[model samples]
Target: MRIIRTPASIYLFSISVIGLLFFTFLIKIPQHSDWIVMFALSGSILLLNYYTILIPPKGNSLSMDSSIYLASIFLFGLHSTLLVLLIYSVIFAIIQRKIAWWKHLFNFSVYSLMIICSYYAFILIDGFTGPISVKNIIPYLLSICTYFSLNLLLVGVYFVLEATENIINFFKEILKETTATYISTLVLSLVLVILMKPNHLFGLSLFTVIAFLLSLAFKQHFNLFKEISEKANKDFLTGLNNHGYFKEILEKEVTAAKENEQPLCVVIMDIDDFKKYNDLYGHIQGDHLLQEFGSLLKASSDAANYIVARYGGEEFSIIMPNTDRKTAYSFMNELRKKVNDTYYKGVEGLPYGCLSFSSGIAECEKETYSVSELLNKADQAMYAAKNQGKNLVQLYNGHSEYSVQRSLSLEKELEEAEFQLKIFLSKDVYTYRHSKRVYQYAVDFSRMLNLSVDERKTLILGALVHDIGKIEIPRDILNKKGSLDPHEWEFMKKHVTYGKDIISTNKKLEDLIPLVELHHERYDGNGYPYGLAGKSIPKLARILCVIDSFDAMTTERPYQKTKTFQEAIAELRHCSGKQFDPQFIEPFIAMIKEFETSGDEQHKEVAASIVN
Candidate 1:
């Protein structure tokens, strides 16, 4: 059978075996009675120390080492061993002054004094009764008291010194040095036992051996426990944190946030169209994508208070304690763009041109709530994003009529556009693709302006079909190689009226004609058609004008060189409030700056190409 090796068990076994051997020798002593009593008492003290070490009482203030010393002192009589203990205590006290040395000294002194007084009282009683003499009684009492008092002081000092010595040695040796010191200490104690003869200093030798072995075993057990804990808490796949560990930490953070009345934000993200990618590719590629996404999350939020966890499967959760809603929303927006921009070229047939993810964010309030509630809110938001159209971000702020309407509108448009663009682009590929880019930018800028559902949908569809009239403009004029002359320029302007006329035929699209027609209208009222000025221009039209110009400036035009997204935005800003409504321009510019600063080149490029 395997022995259950523990510090206390090992120490007890050693003491038991040693005591049996000492018992045999103790019976042969000439002063058998006195020696037997001494041996028995010593054995009892050792047994008591072993019991305390194995099953220590709860709330016990004494350490195992201190208990061992106390046991040793109790076993040895004050008359014979008092001086030795006193000297050791003094030395120990001087060496270790920080471990409540004064308290130990006082306790020892009081106990020793009590023992001395008791011994004298017994002598005085004997003297008054019969054979005891008073002549030596006073001197004996004084000598015994002095001896025990000194011993108590030394014992106190030893405890202080030992504690201090351990601390100092630990710092000097470092972790690597501990093993050598332990081995050396064991070997030295064994050598000393052998040289001094265990039969002579049997009690001291046995105690030393038991203490050393027990300490070593205990240390090993603790180390094993620590190693297991670290492995259990760490995530094997992402190297961030496992789900179980994340939950534990999140609970603690949430509790802290609530107690401190601070804000805590959580973001839940999942790969968009992940199942499609998996079906198209293999599980191996899916795993690789997950790993890449995890790495990106880690790199993006390395702040001390930020935590990222792989909640499970393809979902990840981020916790930002003490972060307000606005800040958290901004962070999630940037994170969404980053996830969308992450590309894996090895995968095939992805529409967004890469692996993309949708994110939902929820912030915690001081009201009684749990971390799970926050996570659930984020999950709901993520589903909302996916439902509206994948690869977007949604902030959960409870339910609202406006939010519901917007979600429905976005869903309808996504489905319709996916089908319509396929047919339209197949006929005239350039016009179809350009219209898609314009729609995307229009939607983005509309959301940035916090437009209502009706306004956003109007802008989205109007921009998408704004150039639909080009189909009738004659291919030569539409794709003209040089600048348009007077007659051609006038004909070019006819597409707006043509687009309006076509859109007006559909009741659903009738409201969008104004937007389509006025997209060419300038902020300064210097534009074509009506020349509507300032607020007189339809809000959607004013927005479309800027986005349309931006898309044209950045895209390769028939007669103009394509400009970078930044350059196009800069040119737009130069004409803000003149060519664009000043109110919308600030938010637009802010959104552009945010996108650029996010370090997502693809998103910036996408925004620039579509808006120009």
Candidate 2:
């Protein structure tokens, strides 16, 4: 007979043979001395076995029965442990009618192996066979661990075959996740042993009551933890990922894609003329639009491959891993059509006449772009779609030449912005040079992030003009060699608003207002002015904040001592999520290192061109 061949079949056959031996062992050494005690323990355990707590989504289970089984091993030794385990397995199999006969046999054998190994492990360590004591603690601990290890091995082998994943990784994950529960089980088992020592029948009955009560408590606690975790990861408004969670996933996906040399696509989309819709219908209706739209995206995408998130306000983003730009664009085109067909209450009144969105797509191409750059390129494409009268899809690619016209148009205006920045002369030598350094940082960051020509133009202008508001601050406050007083610091916080006002006066620089106005806003909503937080801060503004702050720290600021490059980087890492948008931190650090490696001459040239 081909009883043992394939891994599963071999396990099945081996367990069946082992179970046959255990049954013979139980038959030979019947526990005639404690018939009443065994019967009561078995009956109580049989009832307890029917109820179990399920870990959601995966539907894996935990049971309090392990404690009783362990206690039985100490009370009645190997023979009773096997007998109780066999009876428990049979009743459990009967309740779970869908479980195959062979699986039942396997589970029985698994229990037999674990209990026998534990029984021997206890004896080998000189543990007492009955009525445990604190002196036997070492033996008891080793016995329990032996049982746990054998149980893990038996189940892990099957998991390895079924999951087709790395065995070590699976073991590590399993061990980490279940350590708490297992340790709790061990403690409970020891308690059961103590209880059973005092009149086994009465002790077992009381322990059974306690076990069921504890199981119900654990179930409630697990559910509560699951709910809180879900809330933490989700956006309160639309039920998509919050900004913090979205970046976390994006970083993970990007790293995996780069390591595997797989394609990762980013789509940054904006609902066309959403502000008009909001103004016409009010903020309540505007929120309804966001909710309705987010629901549609979440439902349409397969969550395993694509993650759709509300990218703050009217913008939404989809991160699609293992997908190229073409596939992603095609997918977005279909999604766009779906949205266009679905009428919303406020969409009909807008310029587009119906609800529509503009989307841009970009793919990861090794050294060509980083995670932020992939998203930026996608953002650029979305803007390109918006510029093409909105409600369309565009791919970030080489064929685009609208970039040329934008750069040419912004050249003269950029020169003027630099001339205006000369006003920083009266503040301090550091203030005059800081904008130059920030501007250089922005240029390299823009390239690394794959900003479109228009985006790069706007960012460069914003970086050059971000501190133009400081031009109006008193020379004493600007050049102060010490920290500003409370009143003076409060005044310093108005630079973003001031910069926005100054830039808005010139129509050519009007698009730069967000960058000027929101740079000081922190990721955690603690920064000044409006205190806008997370993705609510415009992407460019967030990018400029990182570059601008790095320059402020590393350069000779009047109020703070300068830092070395390494010290400054450590500070950035320390405050990534709280102080700056974490998405840009890695890219900014990489750009600085590259700039250093290329020699200081190139850095000098980039910074000098901003004001020279």
Best candidate, lDDT: 2
Q: Model 1 — which ten-residue stretch has the worst lDDT?
A: 54-63
* Candidate 1 residue lDDT tens string, 1-612: 988776544443443354334333322323222444344334433343343322111112112323322222232323322333343445556655776854545544544443334334434534221122345355334433443344334444344444433433344433343334333433332333243332435645565566556555655555676567757877778777888988898898887786566788888888777788888888888888788888888988785358998888888888898897788888877877766666675544776776677888888765323465577668767877888777787888645343455446555655554464455444456566677778777777877776766567667877887877665576677677879889988998988888777666765455566776777888788997878677556677788887788778877778788999788878888998788877776677676677678864654455356335
C-alpha TM-score for every candidate: 0.36, 0.63
lDDT of each: 0.62, 0.78
Residue lDDT tens for model 2, 1-612: 545467766766876798668666654446475766766666777766665655653345667677777887877788877767666676778888898988888877887788888888988978877887888889888988998998888888887766554588789878977777678778878888788776787777788887677567767877887788889989899999877788788988987776566888888899988888888989998899899999999988855458988788888898898898778888999999999999888676887688999988888765432465567667767877887888899998633554545455776798889788877764544566777778777777888887767778778888888888887777788878898999999888887778878887887666678788878888899986778778656778888889888888886777899898889899899989998989889888987887678775665665556455
Number of backbone collisions per candidate: 14, 1
What TM-score number comes out for model 2?
Answer: 0.63
Worst 10 residues of 2 by lDDT: 398-407
In model 1, state the lDDT of residue 253.
87
Candidate 1 regions exceeding 4 Å error are 1-212, 215-236, 299-302, 337-349, 400-612
